[model samples]
Target: MKDLSYACSKFPAVSDPTADEVRRLRAEEKLSVRQIRARTGLGRNRVHELLRGVPPPEWTRRPNAKDGLRAEAVELRGQGCSVNDIAQRLGVANSTAYQWIRHLPLDADEETAARRRAHSKVMTDARWAAHRAARDEAQAATHRAAAGVVGALTERDLLLLGAAIYWCEGSKSKPWRRQDHVQFVNSDARLLGLFLRFLETCGVDRNMPTYRMSIHESADVAAAEQWWVHTLQLPATRFQRPTLKRHRPTIRYNTQEEYHGCLVIDVPRSRELYWRIEGLVAGLGAAIT
Candidate 1:
């Protein structure tokens, strides 16, 4: 109080050179907070306080692929575009697009008449139905035309075709051991029925063969047996107890309602019939050659 100038000279004032250095790097060097921290060893909060009111450089903003999308969403929201429209246009999920533009109010147009909104199931089906119908009709026409080409079969034709079918599908006697019985196993009901017709043509009794069903343990054996009986027009007594194949849960199988398993046709005392099938197969090979 006695002498202000004299007191000031006795004690020199101090300046924050650290703060000046931080500002210099931030403004002139255009270094990010991380870069400044690396260069100056200043704490993050301190550096941030020093950088207050100073906009960060573009590179320091951590721009990414979504930044453009966010900016576009904001613009769309300002224009009163629905979140649904924004999502479809931006190729983003509805929830994501909502997060981007939730602050904006939806317009009254969303409450318009239902006829114009094509969100209904009927409207969706209408668009593609005609095309599907036309394709189905064309396919059915081809099937009908092809079916007409195979008119009727004579007894000789049945004998040849059935013999070839038996050679391909029916079990044969191996050279290592002697098996003289006729055994045919097949899953297709049509093929088995055709084979039955072939047996009738050969003068073997229609009821001579023993039938058994091979099915998965997981399937309804009784239902399957009933299905076969109904399909073949054979008595339930004709079918032996089904041979249940072990079920492997890890592997997917045809276990649906329509999955009736293979039928085994075992004709006992058919050594003569087995030899006849071998001869027919030999004849086919020779005819083809």
Candidate 2:
């Protein structure tokens, strides 16, 4: 490279007060470039170019905001501090902290521990994945085991089960009303089918039971009526006018596409059958005890 002194001397120096005066004000007087220009009556560019070769005063070397932090990060890293530890203590971005000390060598033990920790994390993640797969397999196996325990239900089993179910869900005789009508209302298709089988077993005419659907006004009434008719295998004439319930402020979760609404099975003039079901429930309760 050309000598800086020789190259600097080539540029024409300002006159009147001269380049030495600008350098003197900048160094000894500790004045800024603008202050030097104002004090010496020289243009900003003239003063700046004149002082270009001159060594700046201590005040001119403005300390970077991160200078102290960078030094601390380097020192701390040499003393076994990790990047995260240095960043937090020095209040610098983790990436900036890493850049300050990444070239430094760590102690042998610290380097070994860092490698082991990284390996441990990978091992832990693999073990957790395996555990999750095993848990899913176990849950599926449990469901299959439980399903196998409950085999097909016999006719007698269904009769007892239906009677118990009807006792829980169907309308019963109350002291105030004295009504013993065989009115079974349910939303479950399986329960309704079993109840239909129960009615058949009792020698009741399937056509005699008048069907009605109780549903929200917002629901597809015609679709629900058709679904129930198809599901129950009943004649359209046997079905009565459906009862539409007014919409509440909060609707039910059953308002989805699969919701066909509750079916009401009313067997007219079945006071005797109602009494027999009540007796059957009573006998079942006594047997269980």
Candidate 3:
């Protein structure tokens, strides 16, 4: 037997200050990885190597949001959830979910496996249903909040809104040709009403618009005409002959009871109105720029 004390005395153990500080920070001071990194100016990889076999303090282990998610994943795994099941329930990626609960063994017989699958299916369906309900509620809440923001529309607001819509949906005079007059067409009844209100706001109360219907030839044209006349309180004689669109079987069009096709509103001597809308639109563009 060699005397280890005599050999050790000949070759003395060297004291490492970096290792000593790392150990002191980890053991005595109980500093977190981030704190130790800042204090010692050590790279993350070096710190991790130094931290081997030393479990982090309980505060570090539990306080993180990711740790909370991992805990939830472990709980779900215990309840017989697979990796995909955990991903769906936690709104996490399947890969991330797998890493969280990989150590947990799924010990089950064939019967238990089948039972787990059925439970997973039921839970998946329930999760989707709940998600849809929550999404609808969030959408409705956002809509109501936005509607509340617009308590009342002044004339200026209507002018701006009307100009934008007309630019989008109405006839605009092209440089190659001319749109000539202010003409708007749309299938949305509420939109048509808003345009009319916009016209009234612009003091075009006397120029009663001649309504035109552009309906599918296959549709009952008379029924749609009568509905539009009654709905818009239009004088029966003011409505022009409807332009029929030839139906194609390849492209399916709405043939529901509520389908009224589209309405075309033409104003007489609306050259001034056209220019006004153009100016408003141009002003809007300039204001944004």
Candidate 4:
């Protein structure tokens, strides 16, 4: 390499003195990457490359965190133990054990058996299932705690929340054309339910929202229609003819059975409600800041 600076950057500046100092500490002092970075003003990447140029010491004679487990790992590998077995026995990570045993010699049968064990579907599936269970438990606990924090929403609280949701997801007026209508469209059943509750809090009549399903023509249109109908419990009279989106070659990932499409809830002649929602959203901004 021409210079450390040249290696690190596209265009080298006047040779950096700090790079030389890092090299001196790395070579002469035999300092580790962490120590070099802590003891010098040089960056981590700069320090890393400098140390990487030198061969690792034949033996890490110095005591380390892994010193207790290293001998056991080596012994296990010599006895034809797989990396996973060594890791489990030594209470070290699989990657850590692999790094220590990677250069060790393995007989043909031992290597083949290890590879087969590693690729076993039952073991892999069990590991993944356990990990997913733990993850789901932790996530559900967090959600429960968060839900407890928001014990209940009063009418005013619901009003503010609905306005914020409407501002974020509902249709709005543009500068070119003035269209003040309270129209909310979403694929999420939970969000639509919350919006419905918000509408009730705003003194909107229960039968006010006109429902329309916007879905792909190729989807189970009747099933989607039934799902929305069952979800809202609104009369068939309030339902508009479902707007079918033409199938396109570019469209992907939305052809699954669970893809019920989006429901558009419109309150015709809702100019006053739209303005009120806008004001509520503005008030929320003022209150938040």
Assess every candidate by TM-score: 0.55, 0.51, 0.53, 0.57
Per-model root-mean-square deviation over C-alphas = 14.8, 22.0, 15.0, 12.5
Report the C-alpha displacement of residue 91, candidate 3, in angstroms: 25
Tell me, by TM-score, which candidate is best.
4
Q: Model 3, 231: alpha-carbon shift in Å? A: 3.7
In terms of TM-score, which candidate is stronger, 2 or 4? 4
Per-residue CA lDDT of model 3 for 79-126, tens digit only, reads 978898899999999999999999986655778778877998999889
Q: What lDDT would candidate 2 get against the real structure? A: 0.87
lDDT of 4 by residue, 217-285 (tens): 999998998887787666667889999999888858978888889999999889999999989988888
Model 4 misses residue 262 by how many Å? 0.3
TM-score of 2: 0.51
Model 4 regions more than 4 Å off: 1-123
Once superposed on the true structure, which residue ranges of model 2 sit more than 4 Å away at CA? 1-144
User: For model 4, where is the 10-residue window of minimal lDDT?
Assistant: 53-62
Name the 10 consecutive residues with the lowest summed lDDT in model 2. Answer: 11-20
Model 1 regions more than 4 Å off: 1-131, 251-253
How far residue 112's Cα lies from its native spot in candidate 3, in Å, is 32
* lDDT string, candidate 1, 45-147, tens digits: 9999988888787767766879899899989887767788899999999999999888766554655424345455577789879998999999999999999
